[model samples]
Target: MTVRTTDTPVRVMIVDDHEVVRRGIVTVIDASPALTVVGEASTVDEARRRLPAVRPDVLVVDLQLPDGTGIDVMTRARELSPEQRMLVLTSFDDDAALRESRAVGAAGMLLKSARSRDIVAAIEKIAEGQTVWPSRPAEDEEELSATDQRIVELIGDGCTNREIADELGIAEKTVKNRITAILHSLGLQRRTQVAAREAARRRAGWK
Candidate 1:
């Protein structure tokens, strides 16, 4: 699956349907000394067919393909070469695409408008076995349902379950259930842990 893992240049293959975009990326890679462009494909079928031949260390893939989704290509490519790493290049701001890419074993997702340096760095990071997904803003973390947000904020303020339920005009049992679900979502065991995480996030200037 993987080629030599030593100090050799990281072999990269581009799978973009747009010819101009492919050339643009190739040009960027040309400027990076640690990378080598080994092949290019404009369609999912072509990428799947050529992946075995190229044996690239990283596959720089676009979300849209002439034949199928890039996730389709990544799935088949991983089946052919499980060690293959993928860096998704996408212009669409679709969160679903990011989720699908990770589900199918993509090592990173890069916006197409990213600076060439960022693209190169993401490639290197993926090649080094590190994830490179986009960071969600602090505001996005507060996107919980209004009730959930109120309950969690109260919990963070050290409000007891009965106190929160009483303040929010809800049953105490309902407050307990919501707290349990919040802990499960955050992979935390206690409300105090949630409070601590929120405190740390606040300290980090997340807001």
Candidate 2:
């Protein structure tokens, strides 16, 4: 549950390359009594330039930008303000993008197809320091063997491939091969994504 500590509406910033999409989100947010639109940007560069000045409570950003991806914007924002809250609102339902956004500390993710009310609700939750991420399918977790799960846990603990191999009594080459297979099975592109997802699951009390 999310609860606001002040009467001030949660200030929101919208970043999307499409003007119409930005406006639509802006409208939805402003219509909420608990949220307000404070600024807007169409590119990662613009977002970087305006973020500090706007000092928004939450940033609602699209994954694809004219200058760079939304991950770039979130990364920069995290550098500038470690406590900054963000939400990814994009047309694409990409697992890689979701993991990247989570790694960069986005508080929530919503597709553009989500209802306007749902978007506003997510912003409110994020503003209050609550997360609103979609749960990964159980079948995805079932795909990992016990060994693969152990590898993921080790990676999340900040172990390198060589370290993981030494810990598991396996050759480094075998560890690399297993990691490659893990990435393929989980629809991830990098070990960092696996680590991030595993860390998130731990935080969520998943075994």
Candidate 1 at residue 140, lDDT?
A: 58
Candidate 1 local lDDT, 1-207, one digit each (tens): 333468888999999999999999999997899999999999989998899899888999998887767877887889988888999999986555664576577888889999999999999888888889888775553354567767777877888999998999966755765666566546677888888987787688775
Worst 10 residues of 1 by lDDT: 137-146
What TM-score should be assigned to candidate 2?
Answer: 0.68
lDDT tens per residue, model 2, 1-207:
334589898999999999988888888888888988999999989999999899888989898887767878887888888889899998987665565577677888898999988998888889888998878886664376677779899999999999999999966755765676578668788989999999899999986
Stretches off by above 4 angstroms in model 1 are 1-5, 137-207
Root-mean-square deviation of every model = 11.3, 9.7
lDDT of each: 0.81, 0.84
TM-score of each: 0.65, 0.68
Backbone clashes in model 1, listed as residue pairs: none
**Number of backbone-clashing residue pairs for each candidate, in the order shown:** 0, 0
